[model samples]
Target chain A: MNADPTRLLAREMAARLRTGETTARALAEAHLDAAERQNHALNAWLVIDRDGALRQADAADAVLAGARRDGPGALAALHPLLGIPVGLKDLISVEGGQCTAGSRILEGYRAPYDAHIVERLRDVGAVFLGKTNMDEFAMGSSNEYSAFGPVSNPWDLDTVPGGSSGGSAAAVAAHHVPLSLGTDTGGSIRQPASLCGIVGMKPTYGRVSRYGIVAFASSLDQIGPFARDARDAAALLHAVAGRDARDSTSAPVPVEDELLHLPESDDEAVAWLRGRRFGLPREYFVAGMDPDVERRIHESVAFLVDAGATVEDVSLPHTDYGLATYYIVAPAEASANLARYDGVRYGLSRRLEGGDFIADYLATRGEGFGAEVKRRVMLGTYALSAGYYDAFYVKAQKVRTLIKRDFDEVFASGIDALVAPTSASVAFRFGARMTDPVSMYLSDACTLPVNMAGLPGVSIPCGLSEGMPVGLQLIGPAWSELMLFRAARAFEGLTAAATWRNLEPAQLAEADDAAGPTPAERAAALAAAR
Target chain B: MAGLSRSDVEHVAHLARLGMTTAELDRLEGQLNHILEQYMKLAELDTDAIPPTAQTIELENILRDDVATPSLPASAVLGNAPAREGDFVIVPPILGGDAG
Candidate 1:
């Protein structure tokens, strides 16, 4: 059977696979074909495991055939993510697969075991589509920090896809694959999803397992998914979200069926929005916001209000300090987490004639880490240094508490979730934010507060701003992913159910030209110009 | 709110066990100072009355039962080592070097 290019979402693909309308090999071939055609120019994917993916597809088809032969007993073996081609961030280990974490230091290392989430996905028959690039050690707000080279936004190749998770976002938005996993520590996933015009979510800190993910900030990092819409993201999350003994911090809370409970009709979705209260944090709409972004964020809020939700002007008093707090906390944790990369251990090691063990250690890290990674390591070292811990690290932690309090106070007073812009602007041209570090930090201004509070937030594309995608963010208190997903589903069901694929960033406007005009179309246009 | 000096960056880099070139040190001195200068905004708030939150969730001292479980073999653990001899990692001489 012929497949519609635009209708290849993970949920739809799985349903078709279960029915025998399409085979797993067929689905894999289509995505692999697109990935091969699009990956070279996009640079979103770090590696494409074409052979491994097709092998997995063969296994999935066998499983489907087994189900067909065994009747209901075998149908019970089906999973939401079965037969789906999912991209993994370079930071997540895949058991003997190359796991780079986008740093030269880890480039030579291969993982010996799968991360908790990877194991979960693997158990359910999910197909791996190889690793995607990321900001080195998840330290930058733009993909430019990657030692492997930056991933260009598919919207405009001259611009950057927002970082740490930029590669995963671009892969999904460009239609190379239907879904990809991303890790968020201080807005990494949501910010990129915004810039790339797709759906990305970061569950409440402990809501997902972090067992084999390369540690950035132990307290802040959480892995989630990027997809074409909220439904697919929820389905992917359902596959991976659960408690794990390997991750000491994984929450014991049960995962809910948010995707299954979603409203079936637009009126029900509007009614679903009716009684929920949302706060528009005043500080998030600061002078630093781009004019187009500000306008689009307001439009998103107005859309919610028109659908029977109440939007209020709320104060997250310490929202302004979240950026400063994250800079200190994330780096301090990173400095500690990265301390294992000595010459005696795994990864690249540099040796010099006069240098002893310590010198060897210094040289190995110096040669292995990129400039941004070094900058954060030094900053963190200083923050936690003997004389400055109280003034810097402790103070940052206190502000972090205040940030959490702001969210708690609002949520306690009956607000369901918060609404805000995902970033200060849209996808920016390369080298735009790199000149000054502080300006680059400002890009996470609106999204970092959620991490500070251990809250779940989802970014769904609202509209285009300045010819690029802009996202509307929904954030809720701890273990509240179900609520956030419902709200996102409501908003998506209203605006995107009928026309989203056409409305997204990657394959919309200039793609036809980039894909290069069909010969006939080019000829007709040239003839018309004459 | 003050910027870091060249010596300050050198000291921090040394503490972090990162060997830096003169050019990298020079460039980082400015960028690190700019970043720290931005972080100075946090000093403006009065956090004296508040307790610090090292983690957002209230989790501490997560204890596991004392039991022997299967562990990764030595070869798997050492598979990614850059330099190893007979299952033991090899390093240079330990004495006569600046301690990190």
Candidate 2:
């Protein structure tokens, strides 16, 4: 208990809780205090439920006390995540709480019931600190598209924490919480984790049920975990992943128990890396990649080679077509999913007296959605319109097949995983890519192909590039999450004593200053300067 | 793949049921055209033999038992309705009126 509880990993905190050195309530209080104090500058959280978190923490404490009284068998049956604090992306439903999904359309809407993941987390006795900010409808690469405000990276207050899971990434990166949940459509989780310097994984499609989570691009969307390290991320993913009868798409594959017990010793973890074959996708290192980022990735590959792993250059031939294919497919699905937001049902309603329903629908959606959302909806509608379906929507789907085949061929060649940079560049300043839509989309170039292939991918901090964190991504074939986590854990062990591993977010002290300018103020000042 | 014209943009917006002002439409025309240009890259690949992949996983035709379960309370479901009466939500007239 002598160590700062907020700084300890969730696993370390679990160990503390087991030995009676600290209670769940104390850990929750420490995180909530840090979140509340730092939120003025970070703007990471949309709402921090102080009362609700404490209630959950007290419940966890009671269970811990009872298990202690009931002897060794009862204690052995407890979940490791019991009493851990977690941040949830605003898109995930937590009953009776606001689920805005960062859009004005859902500004005041409260979820009627818990999402499948929320139910799972609650059953394991995890504390929900609050909901975090995100891009509206999970549409943008930068958090600036959020109607509420942008999220500032903990490393540098001037730069963005990548989106649409920016708030969750920043919350974990800033030590407000050890773990969080985020949904990835096309690099929403991995890109943000790369920018914020944390661990994020997008489980294979249908690996995690999406029963009550907000729909972004139905075919591509998957909920995943964000944590400071691979083991904690693996633990979070294990708690929520598996079959759910409600979501027909949730795969029936057995949830692996090995996720809960990743190799703890350095030697054991490194042994998993030896003799593993990794494919370095030549296409992932594109022309616009920052030299600093390329250097870090090469250094990481060399470290893997030194540990008895083989790295070879590989080609995903259809990789260039991935961006265009994803843009069409995701938006087309989004348009259909978003068509439910008419004036009558649940969200914002803009009906005028005696006005036709068509006008009402038009007004409600037009005003409710932000610029980026409207853009996607417009593109989708145009593509799906008459005389364009085959040329756009159907063509994107066919191209998607080629993208998947690229990954399949590489994995078929006996490659255990594909190693690549998570993002082409480090976090950029706010208002940097805001003006050009294509530039914003390019932020996810290196990571979106995995989503297209429906494979599991993880991003872990490799090192710093130009004083900003660079992420090394490992993508594996479907249902290879256990292998992916083992590899990520091995990399963590390999780089444990590196100088950059000891570094914390540079601007965290500034974020803690009460008088500092809020993210909204900084955004406005930047706009004025432009 | 030609760029969308102003009238085309307006028509698509109408189909999507989104109200757009002249300024919004004007900006959207350029933006949408730029994005369509990006989509033009998909044309470079000849996927005539490739099958379209709508869903990535192998699981399909998932079915469950017909047993019924308790549903959400009507009160909770209706609580979010913008305008509602007892067990009913108010809506604009769908017939016998000018559509716009």
Candidate 3:
């Protein structure tokens, strides 16, 4: 109770709730207050549902009251996430709430029903703070591609929080929420988590059902969690991951209870790392990696080595091809998934009085989609066009097989997980990589291969680079989320006493300034200055 | 690995049902070509014998009981429609009309 509730971890808040030291309503109010007060500068949330969150919080309080009246067993049976405030990426549908997917096309589209994850979270009594901002249709690497505006990294007011789950990362990083949900197609979750300095994991493909959530790349997209630590991230992942009959792709794998019971003791957690073999992908340390970022990753790896883990240089030879392969594969799936955005059905509509349906479609789509979305749709269409299907789409898929094989071979060699830098560099300033799309795409170089291989990957803060946070990523084979979380928790245990681990995001105070320029204003000023 | 020309960009945009301005098309032509150049790296690997991986997780033919479930209310579904007439959504003429 002495510490600020907003700054405390969700699990800590849950513990407080269990002991009657704090109420769920008090926790929800603390986060909502911070989120609303700082939103002008951070722009992390598109909506902050004060009323809805309070309602959920009150319901949680009632449940706690009932459990208290009963017995210790009933109280202990409560979900750890009950009463936790969670910010959902805009694409995750909450029934009757706007599901923009960060696109003008979906500007006013209220989801008719809750997404599967939303239903799951609601069932566990997790309070929904509101929808967070994101790249339009989850296409861009920088949150700048969001049609609404960019999300600022709480570490630095002018820098990006990474994307397209930027808002979720920023929200958690800025302490607006202790946990949030984000989807990863090609490093959307991990890269932003890296940029914002939090724990993020992209569960193995189909580990989490996608029914009712907006689609980007069908084969690659997977929902995951963002938390300040690995255990909380694991708990969030446990809440929503598993089979859903609606989404045929949702794997029927058993959700692990071990996820809920990650070792809490520092000594016990560190022991899990002993004798575990970690592979450092040689291709991940590419030419343009920032020196500070590289140093942090190496230091983290050395720490693992010192802790009795064997670190070996391994090659995911097809890593260089990940960028190109992902560009093609994701955009192709995006184009197909986005075709439902025609004017008449739902979302933004443009109808020329005498114009035909094709014209209506053209006008609606052209005007509705943002620059990055349009570019992706164009690339996808051309790739799938006549005389080019084999040369492009099919070719990309074949190379995807090679990418997956690279991970398979390394894991087959007794490597428990691959350790690497989550992002090649720390968070960059807004408009830094905006002009050149390829440069922006390169932001995800180190992490995208995991998505290509359908593996579970976690990005946890290792240390700081140039006064900003840097992430150390751990990737494991498909359905190895439990192993990855264990490794991440072990790394957290090892780094618990480190100076950088004790530091909060630097610019949060500045983000609380009510008179400061909004993220949109800052972006416009940057553009005008350029 | 051929670069997308201005015409190719325009044609593809049309096929994708996007009405683009000349300036947008001009920028896209160059950008699309540059991105394609990145895809050119995939050619470095001869994947002739490698089977394409369309889906990664190997989940096949997921089936469930055929029993019908209650669907979303028509009113709820229609609430988002831009133009709706009673139970149906209105659309621009698609057949037997001048292609404007």
TM-score of each: 0.94, 0.99, 0.99
If the candidates were sorted by their lDDT against the true structure, best first, what order would they fall in?
2, 3, 1
lDDT of each: 0.85, 0.93, 0.93
DockQ of each: 0.70, 0.82, 0.82
How much lDDT does candidate 3 score?
0.93
Error of 3 at A301 (Å): 0.7
Candidate 2 residue runs with Cα over 4 Å from true position: B97-100
Candidate 2 lDDT (Cα, 0 to 1): 0.93
Compose the digit string of candidate 3's lDDT tens values, residues A1-530: 45689989999999999999899999999999999999999999999999999999999999999999998899899999999999999999999999999999999899999999999999999999999999999988889999988998999888899998999999999999999999999999999999999999999999999998999989899999999999999999999999998899999999999999999999999998889999999999999899899999999999999999999999999999999999999898889989999988899999997757888999999999999999999888888888999999999999999999999999999999999999999999889898899999999999888999899999999999878999999999999999999999999999999999978899989998999998888877887888
Query: Candidate 1 falls in which docking quality class?
Result: medium
- Residue A215, model 3, lDDT: 93
TM-score of 1: 0.94
lDDT of 2 by residue, B2-57 (tens): 98999999999999888888999999999899999999988888889989999999
Q: Write the per-residue lDDT of candidate 2 for residues A430-449, one digit (tens) a residue.
A: 99998889899999988788
